[model samples]
Target chain A: MTRRSRIVGAGLLLLLVAVLSACGAQPVAQNWPGLTVGGGRVYVISGLPQQVYILDAETGVQQATFVPSGGEAGLPYWSPVTLGGDLAFVGFAESQSGTAGLYAFDPETGQERWNVPANDLILPAPTYADGTVYFGGSDGQVYAVDVESQRIKEGWPFQAEEAVWASPLVAGGQVYVASMDHNVYALDADTGQELWRTEVGGAMAAKPVMAATGEVLYVGAFDGRLYALRADSGEQVEGFDFKADNWIWSEVLLANDLIFVTSLDGRLYALNPSDGSVVSPYPYDSAEVADASDGLRASPVLAGETIIVTSGSGRVIAVKDAQRQWYWPSGLPQSSVYTTPVVSNGWVYVLLMDGQVQVLDSEDGGLQWSFSPPESQ
Target chain B: MGITDIWTVLILRPMLNALLGLYTVLGGQFWLAIIFFTVVVRLIMTPLMLPQQRSAKKMQELQPQLKELQKKYAKDREKLAQEQMKLYKEAGASPMGGCLPMLVQFPIWIGLYQSIIQALGHQPLQLLNLSQNIYPFMESISAQIPLNRFFLGMDLSLTPQQLGGLTYALPILVAFTSWLQTKMTTVGGSGGEGQAASMNQSMTLMMPLMMGFFSLSFSTGLSFYFIISNIIGIITQGFISGWEGLMFWKGMSLSSLLSGGGAKGAAAQKTSSTSSQAAAAGSGKGSQSGSKKRKKKRRRKR
Candidate 1:
């Protein structure tokens, strides 16, 4: 070969290598906060240069963005946005400024109302009840901040043995939270006093759910067991323990007499609310329904009697009366869905991992509209 | 399927399954599984590398003739190119022989890296992604979901920055091992004291530094892979070329950087003695035989 040709060949080879390397090392998207729909808007938190994206509920058009006050331009938002009254609360976990904490924003104007600083990461979405906002922090503390003042309530930060990743459930003047330290605590909502504590065998990541009767709370743990406890006394309910094949990362869903729970093992079990016995003959197996080998992470949402489910492999399906009704994308897996399906105004909003929102008809599961984040546009 | 889909099916999925299989067989010890995987991959690629080693040795031996041709055809670029090819054919050497093996391994390296990240599942989402890739038949591997990431007091899922303290040792070890491997395998006599030598020198320094920076920011699981891969590379080079090409102090010796030639002179003497020993030890090997036979032919021609 001529010297010139060899030089050209070498150059092309380097370019090919560079292109292949770039293609191979493409960054995997980080887990973003789940989507929330309320007050005519859809709220989403996107990763890498994280910002809160607000879209029109009906049109799926960009409305506004609320950027939290932090030293760095890009930081991940791990906790989902919680809307209460006119303000939406969200938390930033790892920040360059060391000022990682929660911020309250006006959903309409996309303006920050106030910011409360925390020492460690906050991975759980804040729970808003009455006039206070409660959230769990990586600092192993459950904190209550006044909704109006945006300051943590006096004597309000209750310490736990490990990071508090599960969102706090506030009901009947009591706050119920599950901690990674393998314990569940019932605390006084007024004074941050611990009322009762019960130890579950494994670390907890899913938020505890309260029964309609307000007497029992169900929490799932990494040990593959779901614990049903008396809400007031923190005592495990008799004959209510359910063992799953794998970790239960999704929150337990209570609908009427049946309780729906999804496990990392890819099966969705509908159980009797009182006895924890499997209610459905054929549990909604994600592996069978959506071909999702990873199972499900986003909690199942109920649209009327139709159960709307999203999988880690990106399939969105609606099951009604214990039968698979309709699914989105029709054929191939397009993207992963990490957020729970939000049902509002007869439309189910599904947030994909790539920061796109697909809105489908709740009754027939037909595609209604789709919205991509501003950056993608 | 698309290129990415093909890659996932053909490369990434198989490697991921292998990693999970190793993790399961190693009694759920992820770090040990990574080290074992590195060794296995190196072993698989070892045979493909023999031709490259042989080509490198031949090129090095043909350096004197190549230089003479260059000098004779200094102004005639076309003549120089033609003569170089003729000389290469006569010697049965390919200029691209050393690069072909690397090109073949590049895809495997990429696949291995993706497998490590996906299998480690540093984030919950990654774990979910891993679930989708796993084969249903691999029940033992699937049962070990959420593999324990804590290895020797360090969370393999966390970056050095996140772990803090002596966790910084991972990046340092990565850099040191990479530098040692690069120094050992870098062919010396082929490009004696010119742009090629300087480029090799810069690469020996830059690659390790770049990899160290990556280790500092990436998850410790990846850093572990890099460190293990480098250590394996050093061993592989030692077996292939021996220590003749290995140099601890090349550009600026400790004494040259600091006081004077006392340390530099001592280091030079030690390096020379070691090189001679390694050369003598490695002389009877496959590639070494090729160079030796060429030298005999050249001596007969003279």
Candidate 2:
């Protein structure tokens, strides 16, 4: 070929490459901020830039930040900053780079203590229990990592039939794992042996919550129903099935003798633990009140007799005795809320999908401080 | 509404729902649903592509005359262009005809890519966003909340780079099928000794490799879509035209194809022209001389 022809061919090749690249530009994964509060510090992973921000719990000011060293690009820290033992743990979701990792950091200084790559997406916060941190992996395994050794315990990563997006519930020598395979598994906490598995009507994404008595476990399903399973046998408790209109993705909060559950259909149900009966005139539908009609996603957090409900529509409501105490913003919000609000010392901290952290007075829902990460700004 | 809104309403929304519907029908087998979707899309697009394919075939037949015109007007570049246009006009062929089908396909590929990614819903945000796109009429969509993401021991929502090792086979198969389609539809290196041929030669080498690279970065489900779409393209072209060009082994080997040899294209064209001549003779049709006279008359009229 002549030089001119070669040049033209190369130019055309470049153009085609540009066009194809633009055509197949893949969408990157995004998530709401995963926030946890402990030791008077707020640990938040905003999922953008893959850094953990530690804030003063009282004032909501940035204290310290942790960024993984030599980190792979496009990996979102999806797991909430889990404070276990002396270290705070966070997990990076698997990316095209194939490196999903769990890292332990100094809760005070935000210094990395250790990191272990799981090679699969870690979606749920690691649950700390008795020197071992237990978390669910998208690879369908519940990993039990010893905090001291900073490694997965031998023969302890129990595999499920599907991805385990919910945190493993550990109570009384047993680990309860809810999987997308539509089954809740009870595994021996020490040896990782399966004790009993109960298949539910639909896939599960919410963490299983145990009753105050510790004998019954209540879990929500994508089938829009809450199933109460006997803790020891994985058998359904009779007369305790509460159905909703949409998927139940939030872990049911157990407080005030009421089992509080949020469904994607924007309704919040407070059921009696005995027979799954709705607290009369309860099951607050956000749509009936105002424009907060968008479905609820973030789990409700209890704050001194006030239940803080963060709606997917972005409004936050303080409910007490099945009546709304006060709702924030009173109008349109800049973005929706997906992260469950964390309450500490009478202050409610909500992480919006737009990366703003709104702090409010738990009693009257008054705006205290709104912090937007500098990186997001 | 905005352009993004228009795109979502007109293209993205329908494709997303159609894919979900297919996944439900295919028993939650995500990869199988992708293959079936590819076949259905190709079938729907075949009618729009038929005229372009026929025009491309005619242009391929006129390549020899176009090459002669290049030699006849070797120095007068302007005259060469005029003569080539005249010849194309006389033969009722368009050099730009093949481009229309490709132009039409670009948006579909883009929409399909977005649809596949959204359907896979690898993250919570993706799944939450999926609910918004689902039509209320698709009442079964909520029941199929999380479509199965696994196929053949691999996560369909993950890329080969994420899976690593043997999972790279998806991109390789994508390139292979793309090359097969190129071989079936392209005229090979026969229309030689020109800028267009040089570019065609370069394209025949680059297109498949580029597509393979794209699949490497895309989700494995999208890679499956590319492989299936290329395979469908090959079959569709073969049915629309004849299978002459696909007989790569007749006059060229693998090495020849890799090295940009003209033997494959020349051999394919030779087979095509010989068949036409034989049919003309069998029917007592006019010979090459008669055809030339008819072309001259047509050119004069034009």
Work out the TM-score per prediction: 0.78, 0.83
The residue pairs in collision within model 1 are none
The DockQ-derived docking category for candidate 1 is acceptable
What's the fnat for candidate 2, on a 0 to 1 scale? 0.29
Interface RMSD (Å), each candidate? Answer: 5.6, 5.2
Please report how far candidate 1 places residue B262 from its true position, in Å. Answer: 19
What's the true lDDT of residue A190 in model 1?
A: 84
A1-377 in candidate 2: lDDT tens per residue?
23453565466557667866775545444666788989999887763756788888888888898877555575455688888778898887545456677888899888988887785888888888999989888879888888888888887789898888888899999999999888999998889999999998887888899998989999998777899999999999998868877778899999988899987878889999988888976878777554433678889889999788888778898887778989987777778888899998889988888678888999998888877887669
What shift in Å separates residue A297 of candidate 2 from its native position after superposition?
2.4
Per residue, candidate 1 scores C-alpha lDDT tens digits across A1-377 of 23443465356456545644563433444564468899999988754546788888999888888887665543454578899988999887555556678889999878988888887778788999998999988768899999877789988899998778789999999999898778899999989999999998777778999999899999887666889999979999998868777667789888857899887777778988888888856477877667545577778888888787888778888876567888887888677787778999999998887778889998887888998776655
Q: lDDT by residue for model 2 over B113-200, one digit each (tens)? A: 7787777876677776675577767746666656887887898877798789888998899877877677666653254566667667
How many clashes does the backbone of model 2 have?
0
Cα misplacement distance, residue A11 of candidate 2 (Å): 11
Give lDDT: candidate 2, residue B124: 77
